[model samples]
Target: MEPTTLTTDRLLLRPFEAKDVDAVHAACQDPEILRWIPVPEPYGREDAEEFVLRAAPGGWREDTMYSFGAFTKSGVLVGSMGLVRLAGLGGLERQAELGFWTAKEQRGRGYTVEAGRAVSDWAFTALGVERLEWVAEVGNEGSRAVAQRLGFVMEGIQRARIVQRGIRRDARIAALLPTDWERTMETPYLPARTD
Candidate 1:
């Protein structure tokens, strides 16, 4: 699938381009971003170049991931987001994982939330995604908060489900299903009852 662009009231979500390497490199330099995300410990220009020139486009070409660089209307790079780990594209499952990171100075402004909603909408409507999972290392409160605000129900922690920098870590897993989209359902749902 070719990479597509999405827009919100305050942001533009588009494919990363070579011109964005500098901005991407700068944003990845933040301590918070480096800590929470799995990028190289000391993110360098070469890494940013590889992401913009290779990885981003490769994922699109492979149809296994859809990554977008979120930017302010003025073209300032605000962060990155993606729908990855695609499954059941041609079957009944239809799911993917949602991941994102915000620029250090851009935190707490709701930009990520706004972009997230737009991306989720695209995944549900354009990509036929039924379930969008969000996983974050257990202690990443900011990520968890964004997922919760976007209405992903906290499904609990998965033991050692994540590996970052070669160390296994527990992850908080959450999900947003089709039924949760606009409080409507594409297919009828009869959730099991424990009572």
Candidate 2:
């Protein structure tokens, strides 16, 4: 799958370019971003270059992930968001994991949420994704908040679901299904009887 671009009223979601390396490296410097996301502790220019020059393009070519750099309309890098670990493309199950991090100065605004919605819409419609999952370290309230605002139903916490910086951590898992996208029932859902 070729890398594509998405846009919201206030942002543009596009593929990373060589010119974005500096900005990407700078954003990854935020301790909060490093702590929550699985980026290197001391992110460097080389790491940034590799991401924009290799990983981002490789993922798209492999059809395993689709990453985007979120920028303000004026072209200032604001965040990064993507659908990773794409699965079941040729089978009955169709899903992907959503991940993102906002620049330190861009927090508290709704840009990330807006970009997430646009990406989700594209995943559901353009990519035929049936399930979009979001997982974050259990205590990362900001990430959880964005997922919640995007209508991902909090499923529960999974033990040792993530490993970051050499330590295993429990993660909060959530999902937004096709039905959830439209706020309508695709197939009737019934929970198991606990009685």
Top TM-score: which candidate number? 1
Task: Please give, for residues 150-179, the per-residue lDDT of candidate 1 as tens digits.
Answer: 999999999999889899999999999877
Tens digit per residue, CA lDDT, model 2, 93-112: 67899999999999889999
Assess the local accuracy of residue 31 in candidate 2 as a C-alpha lDDT between 0 and 100.
Answer: 93
Candidate 2 regions exceeding 4 Å error are 183-195
Clashing pairs in 1: none
What is the lDDT, from 0 to 100, of the residue 60 in candidate 2? 93
Identify the runs in model 1 with alpha carbons over 4 angstroms from their true place: 183-188
Give Cα-based local distance difference scores for all models: 0.91, 0.91
Give me the displacement of residue 166 in model 2, in angstroms. Answer: 1.0
**TM per model?**
0.96, 0.94
